[model samples]
Structure formats: C-alpha cells, structure tokens
Target: MKLVKEVIARFPADAAILDPFSGTATTTLTAAERGNSALSFDINPFLIWLGNVKCRSYSVEHLACIQDDARLAIGRVPSLIKNDNWVPPLFNIERWWSAGTLQVLAALRAGLVEVFGEPTEDRTDGLAWVAFCRLVIETSAAAFNHVSMSFSSETTHHEVEHVTYLYLAILDAVLASGSAQLQGTGEVVEVDARAIPKMGRRFSLVVTSPPYPNRISYIRELRPYMYWMKFLKEAREAGEMDWKAIGGTWGIATSRLNEWGPNSKVLPEILTDTVGRIAESGGKNAPLMATYVHKYFYDMHLHLSSLPNVLEPGAELHYIVGNSSFFGNMVDTPAILAASMQMLGYSNTVSKIIRKRNCNKALFEYDVSASWPG
Candidate 1:
C-alpha cells in the first residue's frame, strides 16, 4: 500500500486508478481508501472475489450479524465433521494439511456452506471473508516466504477452541476493515488483463503489478482456496484455469506449452533470444520454462498495445514488476516491458530499482514507470 499510495499521489488526487492485473487488489483498495475511483481486472475469479471482498461496502448491522453467523457456523462443525477425515476435491490434498487439521477445515467448510448458503455476486461477503482468512491464514500449511507457496514444515493445527478463538479474531479484523469510510467504490471485474474492456471508461492512472516473468503460477497458490470455495470442482480445472491466464504454466498447462509456438510476427526478437538461451541451457525443465517466458512477454505485449485505447491522454502508468532467472540466466522483465511500452507509444519510461527481494539476492523488484502520450 505504501508503494501504491506513493505512485497514486503523484497523479491528480481525483485521478481514477486502473489496475489491469489486480491480483490482491492492493492498488484498488488503496485508491478507494483515498477517495479515488478504482477499476481493477483479473483473470482469476478467486482474486476478483477477493478484491471485491476487500473493497465492498458493509452496513454496521450487517457486520454484527456476520459475527453472530460465524459463531453459529463454527459451533456446528463438531457434528458436521463427517468422521473428521473428508478432503476437498483437490488432488494430493494431503500435501496441504495433516489429517487432524484437514478434518477441522473440512468441517468449517461445511459449516460455512450451511450458514452462508451459495455465494452470489450481491451476497454479503463478511462471513466469506472470515472463511477466506481462516483457510489462508490459519488452517492451510502453505507458506509464501518464497516467490511462490511451498508446503513444508506445516504442523497440524487443530482444536475447536483454538479455531473458535481465531475465527473471532479474524472476524473482528474483517469487520474493522469493512468499517472504513470509503469515499470511492472499487469495481473489480473477472476479466483478462490482455483484453480490458473499452467500455467508455478512461482512467488517469494505471497502477499494477503484472505477474513477473518468474515461472511461479498464481493458480498454484490458489487451488486450496478455489476448491474450498467451489470455484473449482475438479483437479483438472486448475490447469485449465492457468492455461487461460497469461504466462500460466502449471499442471497440464506445462504440457500444453509444448504444442505452443511463439506469436512471432508481433513480438520482438529479444523474447525469442531469451527463450533460446533458456531452452539451450540444458537446465531442468528448460524447454518448458523457455516457452513460459516467451508466452508471458507475448501476452504482455498484447496487453500493452491496448492500453492507449482505455487510458486518458497523458495518463501515467506504474508497473511493479520483477526480474526473473532461469538456471543462471537473468531475465530483465522491467527492461522488456519498458521497451514494449515505448513501441506501444508510451513515453518517459523509467525503470527504478525499488527493493531487493528476499527470495533471491540477485532478484530485485522494479518500479517500471511510463506515461501514455497526451
């Protein structure tokens, strides 16, 4: 938020913000908090739901009822355990939780279903936010210290008393965030960044962290949540979801890449050069990784080329992107994006080193700033 706020403040205070790759909606939420209209888009429905949950308005009475509803939901978990061993429809589900913890989380899922019923676009998200927090923050063994989530060293965390206490704590925090005085509304759409709608909507700023060229697939981190929330009903759906997302190369998607050729005529040669280096490196998964890198930049180019049509003249754009490494070869993602923007008619391009990422000493996140010509 500090980064997003800083960039947004540079533009006109009344400037509406656009985040084409609004993953967690950090930019949109920050903009809305500051009374700036925020329009965000994502290919992942779960992320879209999450962004909406963070920015939507909540009534005081509704917040109170959510707390009561959550308590009622959690209390019903004991009888609803269904032998305390059922797992989600996810494949290799044990990798996410130990038996005891999985059982408790499963019961909580059933409880949420009973209490919240089916989720609709206009439904109250307070309890759903609680369940989201519980799943990601409390029960899941997933860790995000690295570039992607890793499942290791996750001890079984169970006990109805502890679950109850944590649920209450999370509910309070959710209610608190929902209680903020929002002067602007956040509109989150489940759509691809590559094809943002030209719905007569023109934004003054484009603040987003488009997925880095790094091979980390966002879907890998989201499978646990999507399955529990019923966005995904089968395991194969994960790979299918990733395939639709730009730069996605997870299950089934990886194999699908083998059949993919570059969008050669439109993309610059630098991308192919990088892919060639990675493919010829003899590194593990080199071929697939190479294709992943090519597809990422190719998709980004398609997205960049469309920006001028939607943004207001002279609108500033800030992309928080990161460099990636395949084997020992470093891919300067910011540089590639800056060049792409230049070709697409954006000017005043600058790539500044923002922070040294802790994941790898050589990897750094860059503030790639540019402006669409007036």
Candidate 2:
C-alpha cells in the first residue's frame, strides 16, 4: 500500500482512481483515504462488501446505537442455527469443533443479523453487518482458519468450546483505530472485467494485484465468504458459473490450448511451449500442472487486456505481482504479466522485489511496477 501511495503521489490526481481486480478493495480504499474518487471491481461480491464497509466510517454514538441493536439480534441465534439446513452435513462437527463453541459463534451471527436486519443501505447497518461477518473467521474453532495458513494434518480442531472472543475484540480495535476511514459508501458490482466498457471510458489511477500462478485462486480461496453472501450460488444457478469464471483450471486450460493472454498474439505460443515442457515431467500430477499453467496464463491475459480500456490513457497502473514455482520449475508470472501489459500498449517502468516474511502463497511477494502508455 505504501508503494502504491508513492506511485499515485507522483501522478497526483483526484480523478476517479480504479482497481479493476479489486480483491479486498485495498487500492480503492487507500485512494479514498487520499481524497481521490475511486472505482473498485471484483468478481467476488463478498470482498466488495467488505472493502466498501471497511472504508466507510461510523461515529461512536452511531456504533452504540448499532451495538444495542446487535445485542437484541444476537438473542435469536439459537433458533437460527437450529433451523440452518445448509450448514455442511459433511462437516465433522465432532472433529472440527465442540458443540459449545459452535453454538456460541452461531448465536453471535444470529444476534448480528437480528440487530442489523440484513445489511441495508444505511451506513450504520452496513458497518454492523460487516463487523458481524468478520467475526466469523476470528471466532472459529479451527486453528489458522483465517485465509488458508498451514494446516496440522495430525491434530484436527473439532470442539466448539475452542471459541475465542479475541477475534471480535481485535476487530473492534481495528474498527476504532481507523474510525475515520469508514465514512462513505463505495459501490461493489459483481460483473466481468471484459464488459467494463459499458460503464465508463477511463479511470484516474489503476491499482491491483492480480492472481499469480500456483497461488490460491481468488474464487476458491474466498469460497466460504462468497457462500455466506449468497452470490456464488446465484452465479452457479445462472449458468455463468464455470471453472474460468471462478478462477479455476478448466477456464484457464481452455485459454492456453487456444492462444490467450495479454501477449496472446506473441507470448501465448511461448507460454504454451514452456508449460508443455513442465508437464512432460509429470508422473501423477501432470494433468494438474497442465491445467494450472493454462489457467494462470489465460487469466493474466484477460486482466492485461481489460485494464487499458478502463483507465485514462497514460493513467498510472500499479500492479503488484510476482512469479510462481510448480514442481520446482519457475513460472515468471510478474515478467509474463508485464510483457502482456506491454503487448496491450502499457510501458514497463519499474519492477522491484520486496523482501517480506514469505508465506505459503509464493516464494516471494515482489512488487512489479508499470504504467499505461498514453
């Protein structure tokens, strides 16, 4: 975020900043903090809701009103969970959590719904809903369940008694710390990036960290949240839910087998050729690798192609991307994405590696910088 802020500072514009692939709405919210008009897009509507609500502010007085309502709403939780027919039958309630913990969290969600009454347009209602949902992950009985960290295969978490109030309490601290950031409402539209032409011609500054190969797919990674919000089911039922639409291999594989990406006209063959070599070493996971490479390249291509049309010519585009390793072979995702941007007429100005605590996503979380050509 600091790096992004720096780039935007050099450009210096209060024009409509855009984050086309806005995941958590980091870019959009940051821009808003700087007083820039912002537009954020994401296929995941749940994230849009989170980002929108996070960037908005509520007063202590207003929160008190909502808190009172929250207490009343929490009272209905027992009945809600008792009637919850959809709470994964396959989930090993015994192995994953204790009955006590499950009841507590479930009750919390029910109480939250009772208080907020299903997230209306009012700012106070919106914040309460977001707060309640955020608490779900924090209070969960499972260890490291917040966004796919290392899982202990030997010891499974099953007791609902393992609930923690710290998650909600910490959330309260975070909300209070940045009380000012949560002032206004930002619109979140669940739509395709390719179809963005219908919305507007250009944006002020574009900032995004698109998906990287071997990294968890955004759709799959955030599936739990999406399911909670009721968007994923709707998409699946509407026939718009496919592998590619959800950042899966089927969509990506289809792209690679048929020339695709920002440099599709030039780099598709190269990517295909490289991926082919990596697949040749496959024993059991060969098919999986083939599919992964295909999807990664194709998705990256789409992002590169979609952005230029949505941003003002020469508008600064800050893309924080990195490479990936599959079966010990390196796929230069940042370079590939950069090349694709150039293929679509964006200039590669800067690409730098940021040294950070490397997590499970990739070997590195380097920042690859670029600018759209005027």
Candidate 3:
C-alpha cells in the first residue's frame, strides 16, 4: 500500500489510473483513495470481486448496514451448521479445514448469501466474503511462510466463537484502515490484459505489477480461496483456469505448456538463449519449465502491445515486475520488458531495481517504467 501511494503521488489528483494486472486491487484502491479515478482488470473473477470490495466507498450508514448483515449472518451460522447440508465439496476438504471448521464456514457463507440478497446491496456481500476468506485461511492447517505451501494434519481449526469473532475483527481492521473517503473511484472488470483495448476506455496512467516469471502457479496458491468462493470446483477446473493465465504452471497447465510455442518475435537473443539453457538442464521437468518461461514473456508481449489502444497519448506506465532464474540462468525479465517497450515504440523506457527480495541473490523486484507515444 505504501509503494502504491508513493507511485500514485507522482500522478495528478484526477489522473485516470489503469491497472491491468490488478491482483487484490492494491493499485485500484490506492488510486481511488488518493482521489484518482482508476480501472483495474484481471482474468480471475475472484480477484475482480475482491477489487470491487476493497475500492468501494462506504459511509457511516453503509458501515452500519454491513454490521447488521454480518450480525444477521452470524446469527444464521449456528442453525446452518446444525443442518450440515452445504459444506463445499472441495477435493480432500479435510486437507485444509477440519470438519468442525468447514461446517461453520459453509453456514456463514450460506447466511451471507441469504442476507445480502438485496439488489441494492453493493460492497457488503463482497466485504463479508473477504472477511470470510480471511477467516478460512487463518483457521486452516495451511502454513504460508515459504514459497511452497504446506499443511499439517494435526492442526486444530478455530472454534465457532473464534471463527465468528475473527471474521468480525478482520472486517473491523480492514475497514478501519481502508474506509477513508473515496475521493475518486472506478470499476473493476474481469478481463485479460491483452483485451484491455476492447474495453473502449483510455487511461492516463498505468500502475500495476505483472506476474513474475517464477514457475509458481498463482492458481495453486489461490486454490483455498477460489474453492470457497466457488470460482473453482475441481482440480481440472483449477488447471484450466491456470492454463489461461500468464506464467501459470499448475495442474494440467504444465502439460499443456509442453505443447506450447511462441507465435511472436517478442523474445530477444538473450532470452531465447536462456530458454535453450533451461531446456538442456538435464531434468524431465526442464523442458516444461523452459516453455513456462517462454510463454510468460510472449503473453506479456501481447499485453504490452495491446496497451497502446487503451492508453492516452503520452500515458506513463509504471510496472513493478521481477526477474527470475532458471537452472542458474538469469531471465532478466525487467530489462527484457524495458527493451520490448522501446521496440514497441514506447519512449523513455527505464528499468530500476525497486526492492531486493530475500531469496536468490540474483532475483530482484524491478520497476519498469515507460511512456506510450501517441
């Protein structure tokens, strides 16, 4: 949030900000809070809902409505749990949440759906879902300190009182921090970055962070939230969703990547050579990993190439991206993107190390900025 505020301060108070890679809506909400109208796009529907939830303005009455809905929902949780009919059929559900916990979540979700049914109810439902998602994660057996997530079977899910109290507490904490008057606001659309032009709206500033070239599958990381939100139903569905996203290599996405090839001349010799080196790394997964890296850049190229259609003349873009290492070979993704921007007729392309990550001495988060010439 601090980073977004600092960058947004560089733009005008009324600048129309655009974030095509709107994960969790950090840029969108920050822009709105700073009095700049903003639009955010993401391929993930869950993310779209989340962006809308966090960016919407809430008055005192709206806050009261949310409190009422929450209390009503909590009141219904116990009755719904007594019936035990609506537990999500997530695959191996116990692997993440215990039986007692899942029942409470199911009840709370059902209760929210029932109470937040007014057609005029705007962000209330979305906010409740966010708090519920936090509750779900906090009480689960999953631990998230490392890149790879792990679970403990011996975990003890929080009790009903704990879940209910935590859910309300999360709402209070997030609302307290984010409910500053919305000086400027805009809508969030569930769309691919490459399709931004089709939205038929032009933007004055771009503040976003594209997915890194790392092999981590965002879908794999988001499974728990996606499952509870009903955005994902099965393993195959998760794989299909990941397959459609940039830099995604989860489930069947990895296998499909093996059959993928770049259709554009977006990669320069340095990256093309890096791909070859990774493929020759002498492991069964090496070839697949190589394709994963190649596809990420190609998709990003498509995204960058499409930005001209949606950005105003001389629109400034600030992308917080990261470089990656594959088999001891540096992908130099930020520099590669800077070059690509210049090749695409953008001007003043600059790549700077914005922050150094704790992992991998060679890996650093980068700020790749450029201007689109009208």
lDDT of each: 0.79, 0.58, 0.80
Q: What's the count of clashing pairs in each model shown?
A: 0, 20, 0
What is the Cα-based TM-score of model 3?
0.93
Q: Where in model 3 is the C-alpha error above 4 Å?
A: 117-124
Those runs of model 2 whose alpha carbons end farther than 4 Å from true positions after fitting are 75-90, 93-95, 120-124, 145-171, 181-186, 219-221, 228-269, 356-362
Give candidate 2's root-mean-square deviation (CA, Å): 4.7
| Top candidate, metric lDDT | 3
- On the 0 to 100 scale, the lDDT of residue 101 in model 2 is 51
lDDT of 3 by residue, 6-47 (tens): 888988898899999888888888888889999988888778
Candidate 2 lDDT over residue span 184-248, tens digit each: 24444565664455565467577777655653545544544554445455334222333444244
Could you tell which candidate, 1 or 2, scores higher by TM-score? 1
Using TM-score as the measure, name the better of candidate 2 and candidate 3. 3
Q: Least accurate stretch of 10 residues (summed lDDT) in model 3?
A: 117-126
Kindly report which residue pairs in candidate 3 clash with one another: none
Pitting candidate 1 against candidate 2, the one with the higher lDDT is 1
Any runs in candidate 1 off by more than 4 Å, and if so which?
84-87, 148-157, 358-361
